[model samples]
Structures are given as structure tokens and as C-alpha cells.
Target: MYRYDEFDRRFVNGRVEEFRDQVQRRLAGELTEDEFRPLRLMNGVYLQLHAYMLRVAIPYGTLSSAKLRGLAHIARRYDKGYGHFTTRQNIQFNWIRLEDVPDILDDLAKVELHAIQTSGNCIRNVSADHFASAARDELADPRVYAEILRQWSSLHPEFTYLPRKFKIAVSGSTHDRAAIQVHDIGLQIVENAAGERGFTVYVGGGLGRTPMVAKKVREFLPESELLSYCEAILRVYNQFGRRDNKYKARVKILLHEAGLDEVRRQVEEEYEDIKSRDALTLPHDEIDAIAAYFAPPAFETLPERSETLERAKVVDTALADFVARNLAPHRSPGYGIVTVSLKSVGSVPGDATAEQMEAIADLAERYSFDELRVSHEQNLVLPHVRLDDVPALFAELQKAGVATGNAGLITDSICCPGLDYCSLANARSIPLAQRISERFADLSRQHEIGDLKIKISGCINACGHHHVAHIGILGVDRKGEEFYQITLGGSGDETCSIGSIVGRGFSSDDIVDAIETVVNTYIAQRSSPEEPFLAFFRRVGEAPFKEALYGAAPAAA
Candidate 1:
């Protein structure tokens, strides 16, 4: 994790005091609600339907045990007893009081955390693969670049207020775990034919009312010129991106209106002008300096497989199931990456209680090198757990009620704080997600359905990333009643594609059953048990699933 320097400490403390003043003004009636809107938003505060919501940034989803403890303290002292982990790898406290925000910000600053850029049109927290350094297939730690972008973009005067909010993600592995394709800017670290590292830059990818897989603007941008190329893209977007209509203000819309070729041309032209700037080009020494912060932990040599874990699994089926579903292969020998599923059956998808947070933080400190990661999938990750310690960790996790073994399964869905909290939402997302989770609560049934991602959003904002889910559900208000729309075959991995709508929307009562019908249809349609739901859906398009959901068309008369 990147430690905050003295300057960082000063900067964060200064911002805290600044916001404290603004908050005091608002409370003292010196600033009206309308006047306080942008100021509050810039500080990552939102006035939701029920109460004020505070979103704290977990940059690149990295957190130390101390930071985790700090958040747990906030959850316990400030708002409700729990906080919601979002799809962007940030956390949200939904029941915040207006006057308490300054004190909360002060507390956050003490832990070197803040809500800055977690909201607003500024380049929001630069996210990366949660398993960046730990993944077996990573070419490099993407967080090194993410941290660089964090430093470069924080309070950047030039790009502070874009036409609309911007999101950027980086993936270091061949697999796109960060969902880079659905970001405003996506960077994939790659090695060229000559073995030099660079980035495959994709621009204009986003999901909202208009979902798009990013266009490949550059085949390979030199690693040294990463900042220059990115600056060029932002400049092009800022120059021509729409300002009149907020609906069409996104860079994705700009790319759609202006052809990809023209956009690429403009970007290249801008890059040519700026590439030579000394400030933009990253030196090898600076890159190494940034990377030194993320060097691998001191690892012990041991066998690849853990005999202790194997023996425990032989006796405990729960342990066997957890190992099968929740663990990922680690880059280090005799170690594994453990994903703590926050989506327990019948619970909110991403809500973690303060007690659970503290428990996990303690476990991370004891077993996983004192580091934890928040995944874009709304789960917590123990990135470097020794395989030999798996049984003990599993037992502790079970005691904490977070030992649900459904990492990529149906119950482990990505959901948003919909109508339950979000004022912009048309339907309640939490209830729907909870119902679906309970519907497929059986671990065996979920494993059988294999690697299915069900993402739900209360509205078209796509906060839950429903557009790229295997089963995408978007809630809409029809004549003041909630109706759920379903889209099938969407995915967010390397082979990214937007899902196509199946047919008419379903009533809230029927939505869960409709999802089950789709799952059952996939199970029956699949050639074998090994065929995942996504593969089956892709093999035979949405026709079969649509027919199953909406029923077959009338026989030709």
C-alpha cells in the first residue's frame, strides 16, 4: 500500500478543514441547500432520499488493517452499524447526518482516508485489479500505475470539471477482472514484441443509459508516455464533449457522435504535441520508485498444495466447498487469494457490519500480511493468505458469518443502493437482490450454474454494472409501479459485450421467478454441466432464454 507522505498528510488535513468550514456554513444557514449541493458533492457527500450519504474513496481498492479499522469505527460511531461497499470498490454510509460530516471527515483524515473525488465529475478513484500483485498471470502490478494516476489527477485544475463524471480502470493481467472495458478510459499493461512494457489504451467505454465497450484507440502506448497519451484523450473529450445536454455529456457519447477514427486522429495529434513534454513522460527511476511501494511481501518457501487444507477438506465439506468457490491461485507458492463474500444469502449484497469489518481486519492482520482489498464485485479480499492457514481462516470467517462460498456464482451478485436509498432510483434494488439471493441460496445449485454474474441497478445509471452482467436487471417505474427489465449474455471480462434485452419487463413479484426460469433454461440448454451460464447463453443467443421468459411465439397459423 502507498503510504501518505508529509505533503499528503498536509493536503488531506487542509481539505478536511476546508470541508469542515463548508459544512459549518451549511449548518449555520449561511449556505442554502442549493448552494451547498456542489460543495457537498465535491467532498463525496450526497443527499439521498432518506438521509445524507457519504462515499469514502478506497483508491485502487487497497486498504491496510488500520484503515479498515478506521472505517469500522466510522460505521459504529457515525452512522448505522454497517456500510455498503459499492461496485466501484468504495464504501457508502447511507444514514449520515448533515452536521456530523465534518467530524467524520476529520476522523477520516486521521487515518489518511477521505471522500475526495469519490463523487462528482472529477476523475473518480482510479481503480485497478483487486488482485494486482497477487494474481498468478499479472504482467505487473497495475496499482503502481493507478497510484500514479491518483497523484496526477487529484484536484487537477484542467480536468476537474468535465462534461460528466469520468472513470478510469487499469488491468495488469490478461484477464480483465477490473471491468476495464466499461470505464471511460481503460488501460491494459502489456509487453510488446521487443519485451518492452506498455499500455493498450481503450477510450470511450462506459455504462449508463448508453452502454459501450471502449474503442481501442492505441494498439500499444509506451509505458513512459502513459500520462501524455491519457492527457491527450482527456483534452480531446473536454474540447468537444457535449455540455448542453447532461444525458449525452459522457465521452462515450462524444465518441459515438464523432467517429472513432476522428477521435483517434485528434488524440494522436494532441499526443504528438504533448508527448515531448518532460513533465508528462514517466522516467524509469520514478516508475521504480512508485513500484517499490508495492514490492511483494517476504514469502516463505513451501509446497504448492497445502496438505493441511486437503486433510481438513476431506472431513469438512463446507471447507471443501469454500476452497472450491472462494479461493484464487496466488502468484506465490503455498499461498492463495481469498475472497470474503459480503453477499450472504438473504442479506444485502455488499453491506458489512462494523463488527464484521473489525473481524476481517483482525483476520487480515493475523493471517494475510495485514492487507485487504475491496473488489469491484462488492467483496473483500485477503490477497496473500498462506494455504496452510486456510482451515483456521475459514473457521474464523464462518464465525463472522462471512464464509459464504459463492464468489462468481448466482448469489454473489453485484447490486446498487437503489430506490431504498438513491433518490434517482425508480425501483427498490436491495429487496430484489435479496430475494434472488435467497432463491438460489443453495450452494450446490449455485455451483451447478457456474460463473454467473447477476447485476442489478435501480435505474439506467448502471451503478451496479447491470449492462455487462450475465443476467442484467434494470428497474423502471411504469405508471408509478416498479417493473424490472432483464438483459442476457452480458459480460465484463476480457471478452466484453453489452447484454441484449430479452423482452418485456417483469413485475417485482415475478422478477425473481423470471431469473430462476432463465437459470433453469440455461441448465437444460447447456451441453454439459461444465458449460458455464455465460458460455451457454452465448452459444445460443437470447432467443431461447427470451422464449422461456416471455414464452414461445404463437405457432404459425
Candidate 2:
């Protein structure tokens, strides 16, 4: 992980100190809630249903063991004994007192973490593939570019206040785990036919009220012109983006209204103007300096695979299941990328107990390279674990109640803190997620379902990424009652698509059964067990799912 340079340390400390005074002023009656709203949002603080919620950024979802401990400390001492990991690869301390927050910021700064850019209509945290340097299939570590963007966008004077929040993601892998297609600016690192690396840029993709997959405005953008090109895109949006309506302010809306061809033309015009500016054109030496911060750790050469691991899997069926389901192939021989499941049965989808966090930190320090990653699936990753250390790591995980052996299966769902915490919520997302998880608790059954993603959002804000789930559930308010709308065939990867609504929504109590019926329908309609839920849905379309949910025919109902 990148340590804070001198400038970083000073800038973060200065922000904390500035916010501390702002908080004091609000407490002393010098500032009203109206006055303090934007100030608090600037610091990543939101007033939820009951109390204030503080969101802390984990840049590119990378963290040190020490930073994990620092978060656990915050969960224990300041708020509740648990923290909720979010779909954006950030964590939220849900129950925070207004006065204790500055102190929390101070503690986070000690570990090179901050809430800066986590909220408030500026450039948000830049995310990358969690398996960055560790993935066997990745081109390079995407965090290098993510970090460069982070540094460049942090309080940039010109872009401090955009029409709305802008999200950027960098994917250095062939597989689009970072969901680059759904971001405001999606950069997929690619090599040209000449074998030189750069980015394939996508613009205007988002989920929320109007869901659209970004268009490929640029087939290939050179590495040296990254900043200048980004500036071009932002400049077009900034100058022409709508400010009359918040819902219509995003770049996606601009692209939709302007059309891709015109948007590309405007961006290219802007790019030509600023392409050679000395400040915007990043030099090779500077990129090298940034990449150095993300170089792979010292990995020892070992046998291709661990015999001990294979032997243990032969006896311990549970460990074997976990090993098969929770591990990913690593670039290094005899190493595996381990996903620590936060989705335990009956617990909230992404909530981690303080003790569990500490245990994970300890495990990372001992077995993995003292590093942790937060995935968009709301799971944690130990990116560089030795193959031989599998059993011990899984055992420790089991002890902490954090081992759920479900990743990308039905139970491992991305969900939001809906009616319980978020004021924008029309229905409770957590309870619905819990009911679905319990209904699908049988690991073998989930395996049969095979790599299904169920995402639930409290409202249309799409915090749960319901737009991308194989089975997407959106909660709505129906005459003061909780109801949920279901969608099918949505995905967040390279083949990104906005899910279609099946039909009318079911009441909260009936929603779980509706989801089960949808799954059962897919099972029966699928060509084979080998075919995943999304593939079968795309093959057959939403007709079967609708018939299953609303009876053989809605006319009969």
C-alpha cells in the first residue's frame, strides 16, 4: 500500500483540522443544520434515520493490516460494535455521535485513510479490480492509474463542484471485475497491436433512475495523454452538463441528450486544445514514480501447487468447499487470492463485527502480505495468500464467524442499508436480503444455482447495484407499505446491461417467495446446470420469470 507522502500527510491533517472547527461551530449554535449539511457531506457524514453515518474511504479498496485495526477500533470505541462494508468498497460506521467524528477523522489519518472525496458531488474514490497485481489474468496493477487520478482530482480547483458526483474505475484485467462499464469514466487498460499499453475509455454509463452503459468514445487512448484526455471529457461535461435538475446533471444524461457522436466530437475538440499542455501531459518518470508505489511484493518461488492443500481437501469437506468456492487463481505459483466472506447467514450482508475485523487483520499480517482488499461484491480479499496457508487461514476465519464459503453464489449478494439507515429508502433492504439468504442457505443448492448474483437496493438510488444482479430487486414504497420490484438479465461486467422489470412488485412478505420462484423458474428453464442464471435468462428472456411470479398468466390473476 502507498504510504502518505509529506504533502499527503499535511493536506489530510489540514482538512481534518478545518473540519474540526466546522463541527465545533455547528455544536455551539454558530451554524445551523442547513448551514452544516454540505460541510458534513464534504467530510463524508450523512444524517440517516436515527443518527449520523460516517463513510470512510479505502482507496482502490486497498488497506494495510494496521488500517484494518484502526477501523475496528472506531467500530468498538465510537459507534456500534460493527461496521457495514458498502458496495462502493467503502465502510460506514452507522451509529456515530456528531461530536466524536472529528476524533474519528484524526484516528483514520494516523493510518493514511480519510473520508476525503468519499461524498459530495466531486470526484469520488477511484476504484480498481480487487485482484489487481495478484490476478493471473491481469495486464498490470490498475491501482497505479487509480492513485494518479486520486491525487490529481483531490480538491482540484476547477472540478471541486461538478454538476453531480462523478465516479471513475480502472480495470487492468481482461475480466471486468471492477464494473468499468457502469462508471462515469471507465478506463480499461489495454495493449495496442504494437504491444504498448494504454486505456480504452468509456464514458456516460450509470445506474440510478436512468441506467445506461457507457459508450466507447475512444477506441484507444495513449498512456501519456491520460490526464489530458480525462480533462477533455470532464471539460465537455462541466461546460454543458445540466444544472437545472439534479437527476439530469450526470454525464450519462449529457451523453444521452447530446448523442455519442456529438459528445465525442466535443471531447476530441477539447482534447486537441489541452493535449500538449505541459501540466496535463503526464511524463514517463512521474508515471514510473506512481507505479513504484504499487509494485508487487517479494514473492518466493515454490512448487506450482501445494500437495498439503490437496491432501487436506481430500479429508475436510467443509474446507474443501471453501477452498473451491472462495479462492481465485493468482499470478504467482503456489499462491491464491482468498475472499473472506462477510455474508454470514442471517447477518446483514456486509456488516463485520469488531472482533471479526481484528481477526482478519491478524490473519492478513501472518499469512497474507499484511494487505487487504474490499471487493464490490461486499467481500474482503487477502490478495496474496500462500497455497499452503489455506487450512490455517480458513480455520481462523471459521473461529471468527466470518467464513461463509459463498462468493458469487446466491447467498453472496450485494445489498444496501435500506430503510433501516438510509433516508432515501422506501423499503427495508436488509430483511429482504436476509430472507433470501436463509431460503438459499443450502450451499449445495447454491452451487447448483451456480454463480448467481442477487443485488437489492432500498430505493432507485441503486446503491445496491440492483441494476447488475442476475436477479435484481428494487424496493419501493406502495401506499406506506414496503414492496419490491424484480429485474432479470442485468450485469455489471464487460457485457453490461440494465435489468428489465419483470412486472408489478410484490409486498415485502411476498418478495422473498417471488425471488425463490424466479430462481426455481430459471432452474427449470435452464439448458443445463452448467449454464448460470444470467445466461439462461438471456437465452429465454423474462417471460418465464413473469409467468412464474404472477401465475401462469397475469390475465388469470
Candidate 3:
């Protein structure tokens, strides 16, 4: 993790005091609600349907045990007993009091965490692969660059207010775990034929009312020019992105209106002017210094497999199931990357109680080198756990009630704080997610479904990333009644594609059955159990599933 320097400490403390005064003004009636809106948003506070919501940034999803404890303290002292982890790898407290925000910000600053840029039309928290340095196939730690971008973009005067909010994601692995393709800007670390490292840059990818996958802007931009290239892209967007209509303000909309070729041309032209500047080019030593902060943890020499884990699994079927669903191969031998599923059956997806947060902090300190990661999938990750300690960790996790072994399964869905809290939401999202999770509570059933991603959003803002899910569900209000629209064949991997709507929307009562029907239809259509839901759906388009949902697609007449 990147430690805050003296300058960082001063900057954060200054912002805390600044926001403290703003909050005091609002409470004292010196500032009206409308006047306080922009100030509050700049500090990551939102007035939701029921109460104020505070979103705190977890830079690149990395957290120290101390930082985790700090968040737990906030959850316990400030708001409700739990916080919601979002798709962007940030956390939101939904029941915050308006006057308590300053104190919360002060607590966050003490732990080197803040709500800065977690909201608003500034560069939001830069996201990266949660399995950054620990993944077996990662070319480099994307967090090194993510941290760099965070430092560069924080309070940047030039980008403080864009046409709309901007998001950037980076991935150091061949696999797109960070869902880079769906970001405003996506950078994938790649090596050229000459073995020099660079990035494959994708620009203007986003999902909302109008969803579009980013287009490749630069095939291979040298690593040294990362900042220059990113600046150039931002400059181009700022220059021409829409300002009249908020709906058409995003860079994705700009790219759609102005062709990709023209956008690339302008970005390249801007880059040519800026690339030669020493301030923009990253020096080798600076890159190395940043990377040194993320060097691998010390490891005792051991075999690849853990005999202890194997033996325990032989006796405990639950452990076996957990290992199968919740574990990922680590870059280090004799170690495993364990994903603690926050999406327990019937629970709100991506939410963790203060007690559970503290318990996870303890686990991270005791068994995972005092570091934890928040996955984009709304799960907590123990990134460097020794395989030998798996059984004990599993037991502790079981006690914490987060030992659900559904990582990429049906129950492990991505959802947003919909009508329950979000004022913009037209219908409730949590209840639907809960119902679906309980519907597929059986471990055997989830495993049989295999690598399915069900994402739900309360509205078209796409906060839950439903557009990229294998089974995307969007809640809408039809004549004051809650209904859901389903989209199938969407995915957020390397081969990214937007999902197509199956047919008409389903009533809240019938939505779960509709989802089950789609799943059953997939099972029936799959050639074998080995075929995954996504693969089968892709092989045979949405026709079969659509037919199963709305009966044969009205014979072409």
C-alpha cells in the first residue's frame, strides 16, 4: 500500500477542516441546501432518499488493517452498523447524518482515507485489478500506476469539473478482472515484440442509458508516456464533450457522436505536443520507487499444494466447496487468494457489518500480511494467505458468517443501493437481489450454474454494472409499480459486450421465476455441464432464452 507522505497528510487535513467549515455553515443556516449541494458533493456526500450518504475512497481497493479498522469504527460510531462496498471498489454509508459528516471526514483523514473524488465531476478513484500483484499472470502491479494517477488527479485544477464524472481503470493481467473495457478510460499493461512494457489504451467505454464498449485508441503506448497520453485524452474530451445536456455529457457520448477515428486523431495530436515534456514522462527510477511500495511479501519455502488443506477438505465437504468456489491461484506457491464472499444468501450484496469488518481486519493482520483488497465484485479478498492456514481461516470466516462459497456463481451478484436509499432510483434493488440470492441458496445448484454473473441496478445509471452481467436485471417503475427488465449474454471480461434485452419487463413477483426460467433454459440448451452459461448463451444467441421467456418470438409475419 502507498503510505501518505507529509504533503499528503497536510493536504488531507486541510480538506477536512475546509469541509468541516462547510458542514458547520450548512447546519448554521448560513448555507442553504441548494448552496451546500456542490460543496457536499465535492467532499463525497450525497443527500439520498432517507439520509445523507458518504462514499469513502479505497484507492485501487487496497487497505491496511488499520484503515479497515478505521472504517469499522465509522460504521459503528457514525451511521448504521454496516457499509456498502460498491462496484467501483469504494464503500458507502447510507444512513449518515448531515452534521456528522465532518467528524466522519476527520476520522477518515486520520486513517489516510477520504471521500475526495469518490463522487462529483472529477476523476473518481482510479480502479485496478483487485488481484494486482498476487495474480499468477499479472505483468506488473497496476496499483503502482493507479496510485500514480490518484496522486496526479487529486484536486487537479484543469479537471476539477468535467462535463460529467470520469472513471479510469487499469489491469496488469491478460484477464480483465477490473472491467477496464467499461470505463471512461481503460489501460491494459502489455509487452511489445521487443519486450518493452507499455499499455493498450481504450477510451470512451461506459454504461448508462447509452452503453458502449471503449474503442482502442493506442495499440501500445510506452509506459513512460502514460501520463502524457492520459492527459491528452482528457484534454480532447474536455474540449468537445457536451455541456448543454447532462445526459449527453459523458465522454462515451462524445465518442459516439464524434467518430473514434477523429477522437483518436485529436488525442494523438494532443499527445504529440505534450509527450516531449519531462513533467509528463515517467522516469524509470520514479516508476521503480512507486513499484517498490508493492513488492511481494516474504514467503517461507514450501511445496505448491497444501497437504493440510487437502486433508481438511477430505473431511469437511463445506471446506471443499469453499475452496472450489472462493479460491484463486496465487502467483506465489503454497499461497492462495481467498475471496470472502460478502454476498451471503439473502443478505444485501456488498454490505459488511462493523463487526465483520473488524473480523476481516484481524484475519488480514494475522494471516494475509496485514493487507486486504476490496474486489469489484463486492467481495473482500485475502490476497496472500498461506495454503497451510486455509482451514483455520475458513473456520474463522464461517464464524463471521461470510464464508459463503459463491464467488462467480449466481448468488454472488453485483447490486446497487437502489430505491432503498438512492433518490434517483425508481424501484428497489436490494429486495430483488435478496430474493434471487435466496432462490439459489443451494451450493450444489450455484456450482452447477457455473461462473454466472447476475448484476442488478435500480435504474439506468448502471451503478451495479448490469449491462455487463451475464444476467442483467434493471428495476423500473411502471405506473407506480416495480418491474424488472432482463438482459442476457452480457459479459465484462476481455471479450466485452453489452447485453441484449430478452423481451418485456417482469413484475417484481415474477422476476425471480423469469431468471430461474432463463437459467433452466440455459441448462437445457447446453451441450454438456462443462459448457458455462455465458459460453452457451454466446454460441446460441438469445433466441432460445427469449423464446423460453416470452414464448417463440412471434413468427416473422
User: What is the C-alpha local distance difference test score of each model?
Assistant: 0.93, 0.92, 0.93
lDDT string for model 2 (260-333, tens) is 99999999999999964566888899999999988888998978889989998998999999988899999999
**lDDT tens per residue, model 3, 354-431:** 999999999999999999999999999999999999999999999999999899999999999999999999888999
- Scored by lDDT, model 2 comes in at 0.92
lDDT of 1: 0.93
lDDT tens per residue, model 1, 225-308: 999998999999888999999999999999999999999999999999996556699999999999999988999998998999
The local lDDT score (0 to 100) that residue 260 gets in candidate 2 is 96
Better of 1 and 2 by lDDT: 1
The weakest ten consecutive residues by lDDT in model 3 span: 548-557
- Backbone clashes in model 3: 0
* lDDT at position 307, candidate 1: 94
